[model samples]
Target: MHRFANPAQFNRLADAILPWATGAFVLLLGAGLYYAFFDSPPDYQQGESVRVMYIHVPAAWMAMFTYMVMAVASFTALVWRHPLALLAGRAAAPIGAVFTALALITGMLWGKPMWGTYWVWDGRLTSVLVLLFLYLGYMALWQAIDEEEKAGRAASILALVGVVNIPIIKFSVDWWSTLHQPASVMRLDGPTIDGSMLMPLLLMAGAYQAYFAVVFLWRMKLEINRRKLAVARQVSMHAPVGAE
Candidate 1:
């Protein structure tokens, strides 16, 4: 990890991998979407509206997963002062926020067909809403603090504190009654859902993970460049005006 901390080496690796990442993102999403819409059978209960599950569930999963990754990176930055970890957190925030929004929107669309409501204050839904707010607040703090070190430290603390909500969101249905459907796709009995539906869903999940990889690398590079420029300017300002 330390070896890759040098941005030159990191950039070289990212440059080599970016094309492969892009191709994987495109191909995986294309195949997943095609199978989701055309090949998967309609749910006996939800009918055609259930097709939205392929997109919605994957986005929701990635939203949570990305945040967890960001939180860990933030901790690494705060505790070990690992340079790459700071960049990782910055790269993940907006991407995680986008996935969280997608999950909420698609959940709403699916709800209207089944639950007859665009929104609800169920425990799972409300906890996820809190997750979105945490993402927004995390990004806001990073922007609000003008000093880079202060901002990163503050945001890292906030992320570690908010991680408690993640488990509550995952287990809300089990802990208490809720309007949202219980976990069918990831149950002890091994996916109560039929195989036809499962394949596209799993494929779309892979696509979402791939999408994160491509975007995260791109953003990390940009953040590193921005920080390097700031450092260079600081050095030039402090140098002796007429010294050789």
Candidate 2:
């Protein structure tokens, strides 16, 4: 881990890993989509609407995972001053934001026929909405600041502060009576969903995980290239300073 903290070492490892990740991402998503659309059983209550869960739940899970990745990376950046950690935060924000948006959009689409409304201020929905805003705010902070160091610092603090809301979002359904269904897959009493529905849900979750990996790696590679260009420009500008 420490060895890979060096950019040269990181690049070597990433170069080896990226191809494998790309292959696995495509393969897993293809299988997951097949299973989700064809293999899964419809719920007796929700009928076909439960199929939306195959997509919606996984998107929501990824949304939460993305923020946690950012928060942890932000902490690492602030504490150890690791550039990769900061890159991780930068790489994760937009991906997480996309997942959040997907979750909300899919939920709305699912909600309209089932819940009678496309929008709700219920506990779970509201908290998730706040999480989406947090991601947007984090990205905005990065773009708002001109100085790289200051921007990273500011973004790191904002990420850390927003982490307080993650737990709130997770437990919101449990804490309050809401339109959103309570936890079925992760409850203390074990999963309430039958195996027929569960398998596709798991497959879709894997697909979403692969999607996160693909996007995160792509963003990190882009950031590294951007940094290399900046360094090259700075070197060209300072060429005469030490030579003279």
Candidate 3:
């Protein structure tokens, strides 16, 4: 891990991996969408509307997965003062926020057709709503501070604090009486879903993971470049007049 601490090494590694990651994302996403729309059978109860599960489940997984990534990065940044770790956490914020929004929106679309309502105050729903706010608050905290180090510290602290909510979101249905269904795919008894539906769901989940990798690498590279430029400008400003 420390080998990647050097910005130059990290940039080279990111460049090498990005093409493959992007290709995997595109391929998996296309295949997943095809299966979801055409190959996968409709639910016995929900009928055609069940197709939305492919998108909604994957987006929901990515939302939580991205937050976990950010929180882990934040922990590393805080504990080891790893520059790349801080940049990774910072870069992941917007991506996680976007995924969280997609989850909420797709969930509402699914909910409306099945539950006869677009929104509900169920434990799972409310916890996910809090997650969205947490994402926004994390980003807002970063932007609110002027200094980079200070911002990183503040955001990292908030991220660690907010991670407690992740378990709450995952187990809300089990822990409380809610409209949300209990775990189907991830349970002690294994997935209760059919193979036809599970395949597309897993495919879409892989696609979303690949997409996150591609985006996160791009953002991390951009952050590194931006920091380098800032340092260069600061050095120039402090240099003697006419000094190169």
Per-residue lDDT value at 165 in model 3: 61
- Candidate 3 C-alpha lDDT tens digits along 1-244: 2433599889999999999999999999999999999999998778999898888888888988999999999999999988888889999999999999999999899888777789866665677888899999999999999888789889999999999766766577446643444432222123378999988999999999999999999999998888788778887899999987
Candidate with the larger lDDT of 1 and 3? 3
Model 3 has an lDDT value of 0.85
Alpha-carbon local distance difference test for all models? 0.84, 0.81, 0.85
TM-score of 3: 0.89
Clash statistics: count for each candidate: 0, 0, 0
lDDT for each residue of candidate 2 in 1-244, tens digit (9 for 90 to 100): 2434477676777788778877887887788778778988877667888788889999999999999999999999999998888888988999999999999999899888777789766666778888999999999999999877679779999999989766866686446643345533222123388887878888879878977887787788888777677767877798897673
Best by lDDT: 3
Q: What is the lDDT of residue 202 in candidate 1?
A: 91
- What is the TM-score of each predicted model, taking all chains together? 0.88, 0.87, 0.89
- For candidate 2, the TM-score is 0.87
Model 3 lDDT-worst window of ten: 182-191
**Off by more than 4 A, model 2:** 1-5, 168-191, 241-244
lDDT, ranked from best to worst: 3, 1, 2
lDDT of 1 by residue, 1-244 (tens): 2434588888999899989888988988998999999998887777899898999999999999999999999999999998878888988999999999999999889887777788866655676777899999999999999988788789988988889766766577445543445542222123388899889999899989989999999999999888888776876799798652
**Least accurate 10 contiguous residues by lDDT in model 1:** 182-191
Residue 219, model 1: Cα distance from true site in angstroms: 0.5
